[model samples]
Target: MNHNQQSTDGIHEDDAALSEFLASLMDYTPTIPDELVEHYLAKSGFQCPDVRLIRLVAVATQKFVAEVATDALQQCKARQTTVVKDKRDKQQKYGVNVKHQEYFADSPSTGMDPASRDE
Candidate 1:
């Protein structure tokens, strides 16, 4: 096929896919209610009488919120994992030294009471 024919075919395929997606949107119910979407749209001074367009807006908003929530959850989990890892690393690196210091500080051989050391 010529380059022009190939480009034309690609455009047709894209149009078909977009039509299919729009058709599917008719049957798909978004998590965000249509009433809420319509109310918000109306409040924002946007007027659309078509139910399909409202539904499309609702679906898009739902998808955007879901994506943002998923990203936030992933970031929270990653931050928690990093915090836990850092704590474990610090403990592993200093656990023995801390314990040893406590032991020696309280030892009778030191002849210095732990409470007096603070003075």
Candidate 2:
């Protein structure tokens, strides 16, 4: 493989694409029961634990970590988009003024303005 070559044997066009595909492959969660387990074991060459408890724990750990990583990526992307939009608005000098906030709620106002609220 030449250094100047655009294409490689294993690598695709962009690294991000390959990484995302690998991430998705690792993120698969299946409800494999005892019957399914026996079937898979007979088909595959690798050795798996006979203990049902350990298999369940492995499945749960894989699922939890994948979900957490995917969620973190999504949150980061959303925040990045918001920051980009804010930066664009600032550049434009729009008449509407809004401040960035992390209310942990859908709406910062939450249907009740502090100035107008009785409580």
Candidate 3:
């Protein structure tokens, strides 16, 4: 097929898919209620007589909110993980230093006997 014909076919396919999607919206209930969406839309001075369009808007809003909430949760979890890792690193460093100090304080080469040091 010619390039122009191919482009025309693609547009027709897209239109068919869009129509199918809008029809499917009627069967699906969004997390955000239709009444709530209508109320807010009316408040915002937006008017649409089509229920499918309202449902589409509601589904889109629900998806946007869910994505934002998920991102925030992920960031919170990542920050918590970072904090736990830092605490563990600090404890490991301090524990190693404490062990080294104890080893040196009791070593015979340091000219200090363990019993004398304890006293």
Best by TM-score: 3
Ranking by TM-score: 3, 1, 2
Measured with C-alpha atoms, the lDDT of residue 30 in candidate 2 is: 49
Better of 1 and 3 by TM-score: 3
Q: What is the C-alpha local distance difference test score of candidate 3?
A: 0.91
Between candidates 1 and 2, the one scoring higher on TM-score is 1
lDDT at position 3, candidate 3: 95
Judge candidate 2 at residue 86 and give its lDDT. 99
lDDT of 1 at 25: 81
Leading candidate by lDDT: 3
Runs of candidate 3 exceeding 4 Å displacement: 95-119
Query: Which TM-score value belongs to model 2?
Result: 0.37
Q: Report the C-alpha lDDT of model 1 over 63-106, residue by residue, as the tens digit.
A: 89999999999999999999999999998887655444344444
The residue pairs that clash in candidate 3, if any, are: none
Cα lDDT tens digits for candidate 2, 6-76: 56633665777756654654444445544555556557654555444334544665578799999999999
Query: What is the Å distance of residue 32 in model 1 from its true position?
Result: 0.7
- Alpha-carbon RMSD, each predicted model: 7.3, 20.3, 7.8
Once fitted onto the true fold, the runs of candidate 2 whose alpha carbons sit more than 4 angstroms away are 1-50, 94-119
